[model samples]
Target: MTKHEDQRLRIIDRRTLWNGFINLEQITLEQMMSDGSTARLVREVHDHGRAATILLFDPERQMVVLVRQLRLPVFLQGESGYLIEAPAGLLDGEAPEVAICREAMEETGYHIESALHLFDAYMSPGSITERTSFFLGRIDTSKKVAPGGGLAHEGEDIEVLEIPFEEAIAMIRTGEVCDAKTIMLLQWAMLNRAALSG
Candidate 1:
């Protein structure tokens, strides 16, 4: 094992609690404490695998391509279920770049030939094991090839929105853009606007 894997924690037991669309596992582990003592803990983990997301920017028009879709989780929280988000989806065994490009095309109708990888992040580290890869892809709205509303068979009824970059940023403050991956990509765009123009 690598040095990082040689940690003070040892798994005492691990069992699957639920095995549905998303797997839930119950873990029991022991951790060495600061005073050379050990502590036992039990925790549940949700595993849905990794995902990827991309922010499509039109530098010349100073606009961005986003999608709005119903999110049951958000609706359950007493907020609007329709969420504005960057084009994103699960990797599903594909590479991050390949997955994001496919998702972008399916969700935004913009065929992303190449995407600049930004970073990877864990949206909910406490209990979920979903690490999302983020990317930035330049696009031309006029060049859209398909009427992207997502794959009909997948039950995706996404609404494509092409908003000015500035206005999209404003939506963040207005609570219209609440998706974590989307927000991170927008913030990254804000910080790297100059580079994007090229």
Candidate 2:
């Protein structure tokens, strides 16, 4: 392990509890005892959160499944009403694969067989405190019927959309798709798609 990894494991008794959504103890920030004249400071933070996103790839049909939903934050940035994104959700004590599969069923109504983990990364290190684990799943679109939005009580008004795998690539080129996590997963698919599909 490198110095950064060593620093990351230096947390002392971090506490995390659930009080509705999620509540975590504020990490105590300490100044590194480096010999410098009031200069550089290294800060390490421990995040008590997790997120999961799925790129639904139908190998047989050459299509990718996505969902359109209204995101107020994006709308406030002067965009359209609906944002196209893959089925994703926060890992509320559930495993990443389990959470993503459940989200796929709720958002798109397709029951997934298994999800393959692509990679894990942080989302916006400048501000938000969150890490996302991305997964790629080979879905069977043959059994897929009409789209299915999630339950209303969860405030999810999602609309399922299935597009050609190539078309999803085109959306990234035309700047139609702007979601960061979705873009990353799609790019990864573009690179290792043949192996993933086979």
Highest TM-score against the true fold, candidate: 1
TM-score of 2: 0.80
Count residue pairs with overlapping backbones in model 2. 0
**Residue 79 deviation, candidate 1, in Å?**
0.9
> Which tens-of-lDDT digit does each residue in 85-179 have in candidate 2?
88898888999999988888888989888889888998977534688999998888888754679779989899889899899989998988889
Model 1 CA lDDT for position 115? 90
Q: Give candidate 2's error at residue 138 in angstroms.
A: 0.7
lDDT of each: 0.93, 0.80
Give the alpha carbon lDDT tens digit for every residue of 51-146 in model 1.
Answer: 999999999899999999999999999988999999999999999999999999999899999999989999999999999999999999889999
Instruction: List residue ranges in candidate 1 displaced over 4 A.
Output: 1-4
- Would you list the clashing residue pairs of candidate 1? none
In the order shown, the candidates' Cα RMSDs to the true structure are 1.3, 4.1
